[model samples]
Target chain A: MRATLMYGAGDVRVETVPDPVLRAPTDAIVRTMRACVCGSDLHPYRSMHPSATGRPVGHELVAVVEEVGPEVRTVRVGDLVVVPFAYADNTCAFCREGLQTSCPHGGFYGNHEVGGLQAELARIPFADGSLAVVPDVDPASASDALLHSLLALSDVYLTGYHAAHVGAVGPRTTVAVVGDGAVGLSAVLASRRMGAERIILMGRHTDRTDLGRRWGATDVVAERGGEGVERVLELTGGEGAHVVLEAVGHMPAYEQSFGIVRPGGVISRVGVPQYESAPVGFGSLFGKNARLAGGPAPVRAYQDGAIADVLAGAIDPGLVFDTVLSLDDAAEAYRLMDSRASLKVSLRP
Target chain B: MRATLMYGAGDVRVETVPDPVLRAPTDAIVRTMRACVCGSDLHPYRSMHPSATGRPVGHELVAVVEEVGPEVRTVRVGDLVVVPFAYADNTCAFCREGLQTSCPHGGFYGNHEVGGLQAELARIPFADGSLAVVPDVDPASASDALLHSLLALSDVYLTGYHAAHVGAVGPRTTVAVVGDGAVGLSAVLASRRMGAERIILMGRHTDRTDLGRRWGATDVVAERGGEGVERVLELTGGEGAHVVLEAVGHMPAYEQSFGIVRPGGVISRVGVPQYESAPVGFGSLFGKNARLAGGPAPVRAYQDGAIADVLAGAIDPGLVFDTVLSLDDAAEAYRLMDSRASLKVSLRP
Candidate 1:
């Protein structure tokens, strides 16, 4: 079986690797149908994160169960499923509270027994709790776009929904989404679906902003930092947005969020913050009572509803996949995503 | 008129000062009936905050209206009122949302036109918005405990309620109040009032913890730091409290809170954080999905209900006043509170 590996910064390759086998009674072996390069994968690709040399590299996937152990009850052979990035037993107190990412026994793929989804065959633990089976439908009858969009429910789309949900975006809320990546655009789609009256996308990319408008952004602010804050404040009658979705995890993006959230508003941050400590002084959130909430998304908690909406065509988050490649071009897929040349790229196994 | 002045870090003095006079139509001259040395006042007394030399220093007070300008319509002469530490217009968006501390036209008493409350008279701005009139009750007819409790309602009691309210403590929740100060005890009271079934008070002082128990703490953890975390975890069966109220603003207090909160729980901090930045990395709040919310207490927003509760004799928060002094001994009151010889001290002008 072929798998993608990152040997070092700027070095990615597709190598023939031994196939995964069931190791536990609850395990299932999944044959990868579709895998994608995630924005987070760029962290290690850029030499910013610890180098996991020669390790399996991808997390997002739409796969089919090829084999299931005796205890795997919910999903079985021949079922197409969306794999959430994290594996959880789905029954812990944290999981019951919809915080699966923090489940007592949960761990992310590529970090635990499951190698990675970018491989042709991968092991899945706690199969019933980790896999969301797609409804029985003929793949030959579905459009490529529809299938790709369903694949997004595996991670990014649900992550975006977590941003909107935690930010408390809904009717009577004016939302400001920071960042124009796939997740940010998905957040725009999510805010709209959540009944937000006005959505503002903060991005400098004309191409992405165009798609953002189509997805549901009522306005776009191309400025950054202080100027960007002014533009957002101007758009919302000088009070700033009631709900701010921080999809960029850098200092600047976090600073802009603090500046643009109205007093008593919430800033839900889904972006994996790269900084070790954020200087939230009395001047920032304290005086204004701005609440900050969000983390590694509980995708499993949101998977069912999000997939239903995507299948119903309420949103086509797959539009974020501006490029696609074959398994052999996995290296090139990494290059395209790392260089920001593609919003997102999918690989067909 | 006489006022208490902080001329240096360890120097406090009672000196004759010009009587307060209404400078605007919105102003009301208040004759101070009761004033107290606040826990926050100790911040400057200990030189943790910048010392304001030759400046009046108290912020909590219960006063009787001595005179009112033409624009002061709600409060009239001889009306007893609780003066919230921060003065607000009570009509701005922030104020309307019950975030009066963030009100655009509001400012802390000492920082604004009102010099300070530890004086014979104070010139209050936004009288109609900042003054919560105590229901008709003669000082001669009412017990000193009753009036003292109303004074507590001005700052500490309302501040405690803010902590519990922001922490989202209610029925079926296990609450932990961190701090043995007046505000922390008030939080215990507030949490019980909010219907919290199990309340844990984390403090080492037997005297304060005794009072804490009387205020409604179901259990007390007389430990600090790692040991404190261990005790709290043990108390909650290793899952931690559902709601943690952080009334102490230091780093250790904040760190203890993170250690004792269960995954997916909320930590509401009302303490004025003294540190410039908090290390809320992936290792801390993000991974656990623990939410952090709170800031300066919006005392005015919680004043009415809190005062009503105290006046009804259902609870007596004034018990926190372990010592009292006459107007001439205002400096001694500060010394007692700063030395920890008294939990709280009241001054009668």
Candidate 2:
């Protein structure tokens, strides 16, 4: 089986690996149909030190259940499935509360336990709780666009939805989406679905922000830092946005979020924050009585609805995938995403 | 007239000052009946540097309107009123949204424009938007208990309510209060009012924690640092509290909040955070998908309901004021609160 592996910064490769087997009664072996690059993966791509043994890499995947352990009841062989990045039993107290990411028995793929989900075949733990079987959608006959959208459900799209949902976006909300990455663009679409009437996309990339505008962003601020904050304030009648979706985890993006969030607004960070400490005192969130929310998207909780929306053609989040390549080209996918040459790249196995 | 002044850390005094005059159409001259020392005041009492010209101090006040400028419509001369600590023209967009503390034209009483309300007579700006007139109480004959509760409404009580409200305490909530100050205890009371099923008060002072327990803290953890976090986790079946009310502004209090919050929980800080930055990265809030909320209480927004509850005898937040002193003893009031000899001290002018 071919698997995506990373040896060091700016280094990713597709190499032959032993096939995964059912390890637990709750496990399933998934034959990858589609997998994609995530913005978070770039964090390691830019700074991870070189290693001799290498590390398992990709997480987003729309796969088919090739085999299942006896206890795996929700998904079975030959069924198309959208597997969330984080695996949870869906019965733990935390999972019941929709915080599956923090479930004690939950874990993410791309780690040694489950293996990188981008491989031809990968072990899935807690299969019954983690993956949603696509009803009536045949993997072999599904359109590439539908497959890409389902693959997005595995992470990015729902992550964007998580930002808007946690931020409490509503018809009265004026949303500001920081970072025009695939997640940010998806947030614009999400805020729109949640009924936000105004959305400002803060990004310097004209091409990417154009899509954000098309999706639902009424305004685009191409500035960064103080200037970007000023632009967003200008767009929202000098009061700033009611909800600021911070899709870029860098300090600058966070600074812009606190700067342009309304006095009682929420700043939701879906992008994995790059650094630890930041101002949360009178100089930032406290002064404004603002809220800071969002983290790893509880994708498993939203999977059922997202797949329905995708299948119903009510949403087209797959447009975020600007490029596609064979699984053997995972290296190129990583490179293209890192260099900003592609909004997002989905790989077919 | 005499006003309370802070010359520096550990140096507060009651000194003669010129009588206040109505400064604007929105201003009202208030004859201070009760003004209290707050935990936040202790922040500067411990750090403010000495100066020849001291800063005017106290903010919380229940007073009678001595005189009102032409445009002060909501309050009338000789009317008893509970003036919120931060004065605001409630008609503004921020005020209308119930975020009066962020109202652009609003300012606290101790600032240069208003003089200290812990004086014989103080000027209140935005009288119509900043004060809630007592429906039937006469300042000249009001009971000490009633006056004390109304004074609490100016800041501490509502500050506590703000923490619980922003934390979204509900019937199913398990709350952990991280400070035993007046505001933290107030938060316990507020959480109970909001229907929280479990309330854990974290503090070392038995007297203070006793008051917290009376105010609806179902459990008390006297341990500090890691042990406090451990005790709180134990109380909540190892998952931590659903809402951690941070009533102390120090980093340690903030640290305790993140430590004891359950995944998908909220950590609301009502204390004026003394420091600027803290970890919001993967190791803290982000990892648990926790939320960080709260700031200065928008007392003006919750005035009506809080006042009604106090008057209705449904809550006794006035118990926070364990000591009382004459206006001439402002210096002593500050000392008692600073040394923890008094949970809170109200001054009668």
Best by TM-score: 2
**Model 1, position A151: C-alpha lDDT score:** 79
User: In candidate 2, what are the lDDT values of residues B234-282, reduced to their tens digit?
Assistant: 8888999989999999999999899999999999999899999998999
- Residue A307, candidate 1: C-alpha displacement in angstroms: 1.5
Error of 2 at A40 (Å): 0.8
In candidate 2, residue B13 scores what lDDT? 90
Write out the backbone clash pairs for model 2.
none
DockQ of 2: 0.92
Question: Residue A6 of candidate 2: its Cα lDDT?
Answer: 91
Candidate 1 overall Cα lDDT vs. reference?
A: 0.86
Off by over 4 Å in 1: A48-53, B48-53
Give the docking tier of candidate 1.
medium
Structural similarity of chain A in candidate 2, as TM-score: 0.99
DockQ of each candidate, alpha-carbon based: 0.77, 0.92
Task: lDDT for model 2, please.
Answer: 0.91
